[model samples]
Target: MSEKVEDRIKELEERLASTKVNKATQKSINFIKFQLARLREDLIRIASSKKGGGGGFGIKRTGDAQVAFIGFPSVGKSSLLNLLTEGNTHSKVASYDFTTVTAIPGMMNIEEAKVQLIDLPGIILGAAAGKGRGKEVLAAVRSAELVLVILCFRSDGTINLSDLKTIRMELNNAGIRLNTRVPKIVIKERTRGGIHFTYKGHQLMDADEVKSLMNDLKVRNAGVYFSEPDITPDQLIDFIFGNRIYTREFVVINKSDLMKTPISPEKITEAIGHEHWVMISAKNKENINTLRHNIFMELNLIRVFLKPPREEADMDEPIILHRGDTLEKLCRKIHKRFINDYRYSLVWGKSAKHPGQKFDNLDHIIEDGDIISIYLKR
Candidate 1:
């Protein structure tokens, strides 16, 4: 398997080098591809950290991702989990504050990534300094790779900048330096907009209208782009999406289905400022899948196909793979490890269309929509 994995890496490197006849032209594309390769190393790190019982205030799940969720009280963190997993949990959520006190970690599948969403206590200003749940707040944010800034938008459908500031300050106090770099937003709707979307107050054509917006907004620091008009949606995203986004979108949005007369998807788009946005009903199950799909898409993550041995009748079924992945990462996850753990494996589909391609290591960088089959050692 090592030999085969090395061969694939060599092939990819060669292709990357050969295709780049001009060093300066394909810089961005090459940079992104390089980051994609680097993610394999990250998978190894995530796998290692999980085995250690999740580093520090962070808790690891039985899978491959180390994602975290943070917001103010009654910001509907648990409710968001219920919507994501449809799994039974506590609380329905409301306009009030201070809902969840303890951390309720939930398993969420975003495309090829198996992510752990940590519903920590609602963070207030000075959380790190031990003021207003500060100690607990800092503890939670200290170990997160991804952060979600959930806000209960003001009565007029505008987000309170101060609330945003509080979450940032609290994280800083907690010792996590998350800024426009590692944050996403979820604005719970208090008003109108259909399941469909609209931009800048105009109605989007379909229920998935938010997808384009998610791609466009990307991520940026309010401090950095405070006075740059050239920082339009696409440029803003390109500038901050990966260099600061960990080869993915550092920003995301949730809570669209809550509106009574919901604003147009376009209005949601303009309101987003400079981060990826998606409307979801953290309480109701409506448009949740849409939100999830947007998450997978905006992050630029590819899904790897998981298949059982050839003897199995259903050999085509696939499980997705993303960053923070490892072979031992989910030992309990494989229906049968001995059966799946062959010394060598084959990869195909989007990444390497030729079937029967071989690989040596399970930790190899997997592209989106990759099909894989493992061969056990004798």
Candidate 2:
């Protein structure tokens, strides 16, 4: 199976490289890309089966959030981990390549939220193909709520584009869609009657092509809905595969202090074409505070103080939640019985219309720094 996959990959690579880019070959190109994606998916599944599901490193998730630091060898991941999580479980730091071999977990207390930080082993080229500890590293990354791509300038004072590209490719192959959202497509499987699709916005691909792809995936009876425009074949394939991960990413250009000539933020932005980035010297502890603040904001966390009955709100340690979390979800998080026993909740915060506004809707979205008191039947 591996040999067949390699042969097909080679064939597709050759065809893709030699094919002309014109309207006549657009559909053919799209189909080739889809086939390549499917083949890669097969390769990953085969590899995982061989390794067994529980072979890789596993860490019980703790804290308000989990963020992973991923980069090449000697990219200051360990240094950053130690700096961000001072006096906690410190990752080993040495002036050597691959100093860290496994995932090192640490806790960073930003404001009142305790964030779990993992320093993963460095990823090398061909990591997606099991080079270095790529499989383990990617598995760790998959479990992270956020990914911080740490990059460093080479001795020649040049940003390594090839390294960045390789890391990005490995992540892509692992089904980790960085800085991307889940496509607004819903699939409802039916018992029979074949495949049916209802598209509201403008379609990017031919309807017949979509139907053909759906049939290839063996979606014999299903209803597909596309709510957004410019949906591509790859997105459709991702939906069908159902294992793809979509998460936010923030880039960190480390070792900025070591550069002989200072590199401007504008140049870095131009090179990466990504707006969300921070420059920090983890070793020197420069801009580490700013980076912590940035991380807290990027996580989209909100603090809600729980007020019980006649007692005042516990402002010291508020319940942390993500943005857009509703009151019903909060109730479920607190306890399953709260849902049935829920009467009405009084709120005071930015989300409320006035001070101590009463709301019976469990679906009311929560806001940061909101104080709420839950009332139940006596």
Candidate 3:
């Protein structure tokens, strides 16, 4: 059964590759893609039931946020790991490929934030298909809040574009969506009513097309709503799959010291067609501070201090929380009993309209350097 599913997926993929995508064949192409997604889900289930092949590094995640380094072997992931962390874990640095055989975890403390940095085994071609323990590496990557896709130019100043493309494809095939948010789709199953859908913005797939796709997937009755614009068929399919990981990613060009000729950052960006990038040479420790700063900024974390009523806020010891965390989240983190005995909160920071603003909204989003004073019931 697994073999048959694989064959069908291959055939559908080939057809998709061969077909020219335009208004004329867009529906047909999407239908094929939908079919392929369903078959792939089935294949995963089969693989899981068989056992012996499905496993991960099982690294216990720590720190406020987790960052992963993913790239082909010898792309300087190990050197970057060593430079980022304060000697927590020394990943073996080597000139050859595949130096790091397992997932190495390290702690990075910057901007008063503690982050977990993971240097995973380099991923090779056919990584999504489990080549060279690729499954284990990607499994570790899925847990990361941010992924640094490390790439390097050769000594002759020539970069291999195919390597970047392969890494992107492998991550995609592993259900890792980079630098994208989850599709704003809501699906509610129904017992008797037929499939119904309503979209707020420009609907990419019409009513009939969505109904047909859902029906083919054995979804008989459901009410769907879309809050985002320009939704593609693949996005809808991914929403249905329900196992995809949406994470942030940025490119890291390493080994810049080896470039024989100086390459302009603009030119490199043009060649790679990616705007979010940082150029650094881990071997020479060039631009290491810039990369560290970028990592801290990209993490989007905020330091918030809790002030006891009629007392000064603990400026020295602030709680580390992700940006946009609600006051309710802060209360829960402080203590579960606070939520039950909550009254209101006083805020002093950028998020407040004025200093010492009294707010009763528990869902108020806290900002950086915010000093929140919770007034609990006696």
lDDT of 1 by residue, 131-231 (tens): 45545444544555556667654445544445766676455423345534433322232233322322332221222323333322331112221122222
Backbone-clash count (model 2): 0
Find the 10 residues in a row with the least total lDDT in model 2. 47-56
lDDT of 2 by residue, 33-147 (tens): 7787787777666654544442146666788888988999998999999889986777898988999998898999998999999898899986765678876787778778788
* Best candidate according to lDDT: 3
Candidate 1 segments exceeding 4 Å error: 1-60, 64-66, 92-95, 109-114, 172-273, 281-286, 298-303, 306-317, 323-343, 360-364
Ranking by lDDT: 3, 2, 1
Off by over 4 Å in 2: 1-31, 42-55, 188-202, 220-225
TM-score of candidate 2 on Cα atoms, chains taken together: 0.89
Clashing pairs in 3: none
Summing lDDT over every window of 10 consecutive residues in candidate 3, give the lowest-scoring window: 46-55
Kindly list the per-residue Cα lDDT of model 3 for residues 1-378, writing each as its tens digit: 655766777789899999998867877887898887777666444433332332257677888889999999998999899988957779999989999998899999888889999899999986665578676777777779899899987777766557888998888876789888899999899997899989997888888778877886678999988888888888989999998889988789898887887778788788778777888888888988888889888889899998999998899888888888999989888899889999999999999999999987689999999999999999
Please give the lDDT score at residue 23 for candidate 1: 29
